[model samples]
Structures are given as structure tokens and as C-alpha cells.
Target: MEVEITTEEKILIAARKVFIEKGWDGARMQEIADNAGINKALLHYYFRNKEQLFKRVFAGIVGKLIPNLNTIIQSEQPIFEKIQAFIDAYLDFLLANQELPLFVANELSRNANLIVGAFEENGLKPMVGQMVMEIFQAIENKQIRPINPAHLLMNIVSMCVFPFMGRSIFQKVLMQVPEEMYQELLKQRKKEIYEMVYHSIVL
Candidate 1:
């Protein structure tokens, strides 16, 4: 069955693209309307102004992507298995939402508090203690070498995020790689990242 998409949804989709590409300061209402195939009056009717529209777009994207990090720390699977699962899920999500990494990186640089607030509002916080305990347990079991969970978390995030975040520059300017090849490289990242992380910590 064909799903019906409402006007509001259309607006939001259009806004997401514009906000990601042009960013909050660069996006304009008329451009969003053109993207959505709607008039400015209707856009304004749906979203009173640019700020309101941007907030909804930002929140929607962050809510979808950021909260899933909890699953890796909370899972009952062994540490290596959890890492593999996280890489699979995180990379898949990032690949499907290519624009998201840059958008998130930019937002985090400009107004980090907003991103933090979004996570808190979405009930994705208060897991730090749990994550630390999980890491300690893994080390005690000799599943991984003893290390600060924060460093491990950052390593995971950087490996998963930097490629997408620097796609244009790294893949295009410096590497001068063809889009097809870069895409193929991305396809192999799940295993590549898993092996790298596993070897870093495992005995």
C-alpha cells in the first residue's frame, strides 16, 4: 500500500535538506518552500518562522540518531559483540543519512548545549555510570584491556563519524577518489572498524 504523506511532513523533509546543506543561518524560508513545492504563506502557516522550523528539524534528526548509542552500553552481549553491533548499526544509520554527520558536527560546534538538551529531553542521558560499569566489568573479565571508557567512546565516535563528516574534503580533494570507490570503501568500514577496535583492546 502507498503511504500518504501529509503537508507537514513534506515541509519537514524539505526543511531537513535545506538546514543540513545551508545550515540554520544560511537557510531561507523561500528556498524551503521551493523545495517543498509550497508557498511561503503555507510554510509560515505550518512553521511560524525559520527558528521554529529549524528546531523541529534538528530535534527530529538528533532524536532519531543519537539515542541509539545507549543500546551498545546496555546490551548483554560480550564487549566485542556489542562493539561489532554498534559499528554495524551506527555506520548503517550514518550511510543512510549522509547529510546528518555534517549537520550534527556543525550544530555541535555552534551550540553544543542545544544538542545536549535534545538528548536530555529525549531521555537518552543518565547512562554514563552504566557505561562506565560495563567497561570496568569487561576489563575485569579480560575481554578488553583496562582503559578509560571515555577514550574508548571517543575513539568509536571519531572512527564512525570523521569519514562522513570530512567526506567532501578527504574523498574529493585530498584522496581524489571516485564516488564509486569511496562508496565501496565505506561499505567495508563495518568490518574494518570492528577489527581495529577489537585488536586495540583485546589480548
Candidate 2:
């Protein structure tokens, strides 16, 4: 059975594509409306301005990414397994949305408050707190070496997100690999990240 997409969904779909390709500063309302197969006035009727539409798109992406974390954090998996699972899931998401990191980084530079607000509203703070508590529990149980949970969390996120965020340099200058090869490398990165993180904190 086919599920019908609503007008708002269509708009959001089109907006995501445009935003990813162009970044918030580069994206235009008319272009988004055209991509959505709607007139500019109609698009305005749905979204008052480009900023509003961009916020919705950013919030939607956060919404998609956070629930996965919530699930992983609440699971009964061991610490190492949880780390591996997060890396796998996060990398998989980055692979599917290859342009997202760059898009997010660009927008964040322009208006960090907006991005931060979106994340906070989507429950990122509580999720991070829960993850931190998990790390502390692991340390107390002697499952991993004692370390500041915040630093460990930051390290894990940086390792996973940096490659995609710096894709142009990493792909073209650093590695000089073709797109196909770079993508293959990203797939391999999931394991590499897990190992590096595991060895760093493991007893």
C-alpha cells in the first residue's frame, strides 16, 4: 500500500534537498517552492519565511537522529556494545545524508543559537545526561578505564562526525580518493571508530 505524502511533507522534502545542497545562507524560498512543485505564495502560506522553513527542516533532522540515540541509550547493551552500536547507527545516518554535516556546520557558524535551540528542544540535553551517567556507571563497574565522561562523549562524537563535516578536504586533499572510494572508506570508518574508541577507554 502506498502512503500519501501531505503538502507539508512535500514541502519539507523539497526544503531538505535545497538546504543540504545550498546551506541556509544559500538556499532561496523560490527555489524551494519550485522544487516542491508549489508556487511561492503557496509556500509562504505554509511557511512564513525561509528561516521558519529552515528551522523546521533542522528540527526534523534532529528529531530523526535523536530517537535512535534514545533507543540505544535505553537498551540493555553493554558499554562497549553501546558505543559500537552508536557509531554504527550514527555513521549509517551520515552515509545516507552525506551532505548533512557540511550543511549543519555552515548553518551553525551563521547562527549557533538557532541550532543549539533546536537540539535542546529535541531532547539532546537529557540524552547526553543519560549517556554521561551510563559512562560513569561503566567506570564504577570497572568496565572501562576511569575518564571524564564528557570528554569521552566528545571524543566519540568528534571522531564520528569530523570526517563527514570535513568531507571536501578529507575526500579531495587529504585522501584524494574518488567519491566511490571515499564512500567505501566511510563504511569502513564505523569499525575503525569503534576500535579506536574502545581501545582508548577499555581496561
Candidate 3:
């Protein structure tokens, strides 16, 4: 079945591709419009300017990642189950949007306040506190080691997110693996992270 694509939708998708390949500095409004098969005037009519367009695209990215995240953290699932599911789902999100992470990192370097604003609008702050308390209870029950779960959680996230952010370097400077081989390496990481974390946390 063929799905319909709107002019705005086309522009956003095209912008996402360009921004990922070029980063914001290298991306051009005219190039985005060309990619979308629309004129720059039409793009402006919808998005106003480059910064506005990036914010809209970034909001879409955050929305995709955050909603289900809050639900999983607040759920009554055991920590191990949550760990497996969270890693799987998060990796899926990363793979689906390969350009998303770098664009976000680039944009964050420019204006953290913008991303913070999106988090506020999206109600992400409350979820952090919720996850911390959930972790506290798991520790009290001896389900996991007595680590500061918040810091531990942050480390887990960094372990996952950093490799993607550093993908170019990992492939070129480190392993020097070409495209197909490097993808297989990433496939291994999905389970490896879970195993590494599980063994570290359990006695």
C-alpha cells in the first residue's frame, strides 16, 4: 500500500536526511527544499526559518523516544525485564533514526536551552524522579547491587548513545570496519550490553 506524503511531511523528512548527513551548519535551506521537491518559498511558508525547522524536527525525535520511556520506567516490571526491553527498544529507536543522534548532539552544542524546553513541554523531568524511586525500591529489595541507580542509569545510557555519536570514529579510527561488518558489530552490542550490565549488577 502506498502511503500519502504531505508537503510539510516531505520537507521534514528531507531536512532530517540532510541535517544528519551535513549537520545543521552544512545543511542549506535551498538544498532541503530541493530534496523535498518544493521551492524554498514553500518551505519558508511552512517552517519560517532554518532554526524553526530544526526545532520542529527535533521535537518529533524527542516525542518518538520519550513517551514509551516514561511508561516503562513507571511500570511494575522487574528491573532485569525492564533492562532487556529498554535496551532493545532504545537500540531499535537508534537504528531507525541513524541521523537523529548526531543532529541532536550538534543542536545541543548550539542551544541546550531549546532541548530543555522540549523536555519540559514533553514532561520528561517527572519521569527521572520516578525512575530513581523505582530503582531505590529495587535496591532495598536486593534485586540489584547498591549502586546509585541514577548514576548507573546514566552510565548505561552513555554506553549506548556514545557509540552511535562516535560511529564515524569507531569505524574509521578504531576498528576500520567497512559498512556491512560494522553493522554486525552493532548487532552484537545489543545483547552484549545487556549481558555486561546483568553480570555486573548481580552478585
Candidate 4:
């Protein structure tokens, strides 16, 4: 016998695909319903509307990524090790979810507050505090150069995320590397970013 998927799961699954493909602005409830093999009224009954549905979808995407950063921050590893691990995990996640950054960036532009709410709801503050404490400890031990941890974090995130943001341009226009070669290059980038981040701050 075929297992039955719940109405909510079916809607969310369909919504995830639609949102990933067309983004929040372009995705319509009717399309989501049709893809879900349900009617529009049922979709609305579960999600209320596109904004609400998109938020749930966005939260699921963000949920996959954010907690990993928290783990790296809260770990007992040395700063350099943390940097290496973070680059490895972060880049790997982004490469696997190539469409995610653009979707997040687009949604954030129009719904910054909503995105902030999602982070807050997920307990971002304690994770941020843990990271801050780690940065302070590293600086105090003179294991790393003195720098604003928040700024440093942003720099690291930007370096890690920019390639994904420019994926189409980088793959299709500028470097024009073959698919297999491009993927290999991304693997190399994990090391390159780790080294650059480590050397920049290491004593």
C-alpha cells in the first residue's frame, strides 16, 4: 500500500519547490496547490496565503544552515580549527543548495524584518554571544590578531557566500569552467577560504 502524505507535508513540499524555482514574488498559491495535487482552498486552509507559506518555507531552508554555525561557535576547538571546519561545512552546504542564497537574498530585500524574526524565533542571540566569547578568547590569548568579531564574521560569511551569489555569472560567463571542473574548483575553494581566513587573523 502507498503511504499517505499529510495535507500539510504535501503543501509544504510543493511550496518548497515553487518557492525555490520562482521565489516568493513569483510563486502563486494556485500553482502550489496544483503541484501539491490539491485544490487552492485546501492550500489556503493550511497556509493562509503566500506570505505565510513563504515564511514557513524560508524558515525550513534557513533551519538547515544556521544551527551549524552555532555548533562551530560553541565548540572547544581552536580558532583556526573552527575556521577550517566552518568553511568546510558552510561551503559544502551552499554548493549542495545552489539556489538558496539567491532565494534568501531576494526575500531579505523585501522582508528584512520577517527574516530577522525567523532568526530570533530560532534563538540566534545565544549562538551569537557564544561566538563573540570565542572571538574574545582567541584575541586575549593572542592566537589571532585583534579585530571586531562581528566584522570578521561578516567578512568570512561574505567570502563564503559570494561564489554562490555569483554562481550563474561565474559558471556561465567569467571563468566558464566545465561542470565537473567547476565543482572541483569549489572543493578547492574550501581550503583556499580557510587558509585566507586563518592567515589573516593568526599571529
Which structure among the candidates has the greatest lDDT?
Answer: 2
**After superposition, candidate 3 runs with Cα above 4 Å error:** 121-126
Cα lDDT of model 3 by residue, 101-128, tens digit:
7767887898787777766765555377
Once fitted onto the true fold, the runs of candidate 2 whose alpha carbons sit more than 4 angstroms away are 1-4, 121-126
lDDT of each: 0.83, 0.86, 0.81, 0.82
Scanning candidate 2 in windows of ten residues, the lowest lDDT window is: 118-127
Q: Please rank every candidate by TM-score, starting with the best.
A: 2, 4, 3, 1
Candidate 4: 10-residue stretch with minimal lDDT: 118-127
lDDT tens digits, residue span 1-203, model 1: 99989999999999998888888778899999999999999999999988778777767776665567666667788777877887887898888888788887898898787666656665656356787788888999988899989998789879988999999998989999999999888888999999999899887
Better of 1 and 2 by TM-score: 2
Full candidate order by lDDT, most accurate first? 2, 1, 4, 3
Give model 2's clash tally.
0
TM-scores of all models? Answer: 0.87, 0.91, 0.87, 0.90
Task: List all candidate RMSDs to the true structure.
Answer: 2.3, 1.9, 2.2, 2.0
Candidate 3 lDDT at 119 equals 68
lDDT tens per residue, model 2, 20-56 = 8888778899999999999999999999988778778
- Decide which is better by lDDT, 1 or 4: 1
| Winner of 2 and 4 under TM-score | 2
